[model samples]
Target: MKKTLLVFGLLLAVNYMFSQGCSDAGICSINHGFQSEDKSFKSTLELAAIYSLGEADVGYFSPYISYTKRFSERFSFTSKVTYSTAHGSFGTRSQFGDAFLIGNYTFKEKNKKQWSTLLGFKFPFTASNLKINGYSLPLDYQSSLGTIDLFLGTNLHYKYWDFNGALQLPIVNLNNNSYFKEYGGTNDFPSTNLFERKPDALLRATYSLKTPNKKFTFKPNVLFIYHLGKDSFENIFGQRENIKGSDGLTINGNIITSYSLTKQSSLELSLATPFVVRDSRPDGLTRSFVLGLQYQYSF
Candidate 1:
């Protein structure tokens, strides 16, 4: 019985690791480190292919380009642009994704431990005016929610491990062109989604490994996110509708592999999958696989 208990405990620990990942669904970058690659200039090009089955069916491909520049050892800036092509059973569409920018500052370092903070903003670029057969497409079919978001986070690095946490608040999310009418056909005219979103929080931990040849590195991580509840929406019929069941928790396990082809160039691949979930998740994710390939160059 003691042996069986020990095995069960080990399994539990593995399950929890996947839940602590630092990345989220909206993130497009593949660089998951605590600092800016410890260099002065870095350029990254990444392509992500995501297949989401089950309740939400989608095939999405997004390309991300990022440039991180360092002025000194203590501070760096990163700017990334993204575009996506997506297809579903209903139809196909392509659009530019949200713009992502972040400034990183490292502070509080002593005894092989370092702390870094990230302050960033995402600009609104996606348009939500999508309709098929004269009816509004479901929210899942829209490529982006068109929100300007602000982000703040910090990372703690100790040896070969990193603990990262972040919060994202959507300050402005508005798309007045199309409206999703209430189900069951209420007595109100269709109105756009005018509700403000709650803050989304994430926590992740990553452990890095280097190959004996010093040409490759492996990183495995766990991520967890808590999506807070949404606000109420005012309808065209002078009524307020409270959207519920939209708050929940999710956990994912991700692995990233990198190979250095040369001193200035490298390639990376990443995979993420969710394993556990809880609470009322209206329009929640059932299961998904995000596969990514990234090429990096530094000079």
Candidate 2:
């Protein structure tokens, strides 16, 4: 167990340096660079639900679902959907939904992980409606912005630790034009341009410790995110002007524990905290606390 813990700790250190070094150039943000890989031609499902409570904000809820299936030892595909809604005393109530698809590939043999790559495409079908102080908005405000995304990513895993990252680029940005014209309600609204570079990169690293029974494991992870681009979140309802050009850094750490219930079943729990945040929007919402639970079954 001590050896496992040491290994994971080293991985975490490496991830931290990798993320920080990106600012020097020729390096990528950690969020989109490093991620774990599961190489089974099997199906994995995830269901996430979250609720936030605060001052006048009252509360907000989000429910997300994803399904992933591997076609071969090193090839896989995934699909996901998310629904979110919020109500506030500021006389604001809104709801939004999105759907996406992704594909993944591994270059190494098994989990050796010299290099693993993932390429994906996402088609977003978004529908949203908002009301402030009990007043109706324009029709375009309640419609969908048809758009697509292209993503490329890689992961490097050593004996005791691993690094994962990815980059997401927009391929079809029709949604931006539609949103600006509809939400901005002005002919001078910004135009959708694909040549712009957006900050959609991520990186993460984790180390693991095994218990004497081998059935129990503990893992600590660190994560970072960078949002780049001029109009990245523009047109998105509720987004503040400060969030634009608001490129900075955020760091989060999580500790996860897993206990084996049986050869085919296991229970997992995680606790996390946002340890660092830079240039965070003053009005932006930050995660205060997170709790995770998962059950696994194999056939």
Candidate 3:
């Protein structure tokens, strides 16, 4: 039975390698509970590739590089950068996404329980407006949201279980162009020009199951996200209109599996799919599914 399950898991991971998606906003990238707790390692480096399929057949391919530095037993900092490309029927567009700088502070770690706080900043690298063939592309085709965002969150670990909560807020909004609105009556895309996005809150729970030899670990997690307020977009008449049904909840199920290759290196595979979705994702953050593969090195 164990061998059967292991083969099934491996097959699933390989099949999903071509897609990736998650936390449509920014909270999903905060490195909530995956940081190394081993004090012996002063720093670690990670390289990850992700593929996501969104509504309207839009596809995203993102490559990420991240570095984490352990300053002390209870403090650490992480920095990550991503380059993304979007392709679909409209064409292809690629650019640098947002950059993330996160700090984690542990408050307690005793008797198989740990508590930590997270604070981070998201710096935009693009204007969130990309043009293909002289046509404005939607948010799904853009790499960045073009906003300076603040992230605050907390994580609690008890034995093999993990719980996390977070909030992502835009401190500065720079996305104001009408994405694909210029194409107008010629296309079926939604109006996202001068898009104004709202804040999002996240909650996640996960359980880790490990093999007897400790070489393999499987983590299954459920993620919940709530859009705080309705998003708005400028209409052709030059008036801001609220996107109805935009403020709602989304629930997703995710699985992450890891294999230890050596003392200093490992490989991770993750897949995510939504169980519940909101009606209007005007921010163009909607994802049908996400898959990722990552390699990590520690020293």
Model number with the top TM-score? 3
Candidate 2 structure quality by residue, lDDT tens digits, 1-299: 56765665565445443322112011122222233333432766656665533222334465666666767776767676755555543334445445666676667656564677777765544422243544432212222233456667777777767677766666665432223334434432232211122435667786767787878878777767565544343334544333343356666666778888776556677655455554432212334444556565433
* Superior candidate under lDDT, 1 versus 3: 3
Model 3 / residue 159 / CA error / Å: 0.8
| Pairs in clash, predicted candidate 3 | 19-51, 19-291, 20-51, 20-52, 20-290, 20-291, 21-290, 177-194, 178-193
Q: Order of all candidates by TM-score, from best down to worst? A: 3, 1, 2
| lDDT (Cα atoms) of all candidates against the true structure | 0.62, 0.50, 0.80
Local accuracy of candidate 3 as per-residue lDDT tens digits, 1-299: 46745754565455444333334777865754345545788888999999888867788899999988999888899999989999987789999988999999887678888889999999989878888877787887888888889999998889888888999999999985566455644354568878888999999888788999988988877789998999888888889889898888887777889999987888999887776778777776777778899999889
- TM-score of each candidate structure, all chains considered together: 0.79, 0.64, 0.90
Give Cα distance to truth, residue 96, candidate 2, Å. 5.7
Can you tell me which runs of candidate 2 are displaced by over 4 Å?
Answer: 1-41, 51-58, 90-96, 110-113, 125-129, 132-147, 173-197, 230-245, 280-285
Report the lDDT tens digits of candidate 1 across residue range 1-299.
34643554455456444432222435323234345573544444434444433233456676777777776678777777777666666567677766778888888679999999888888867555566666655444455556788888888899988888888888777543345456414322223455444667888888787888979887777777787664345566757665664466777767778899887778888766666664333221233556678787777
User: Best candidate per lDDT, number?
Assistant: 3
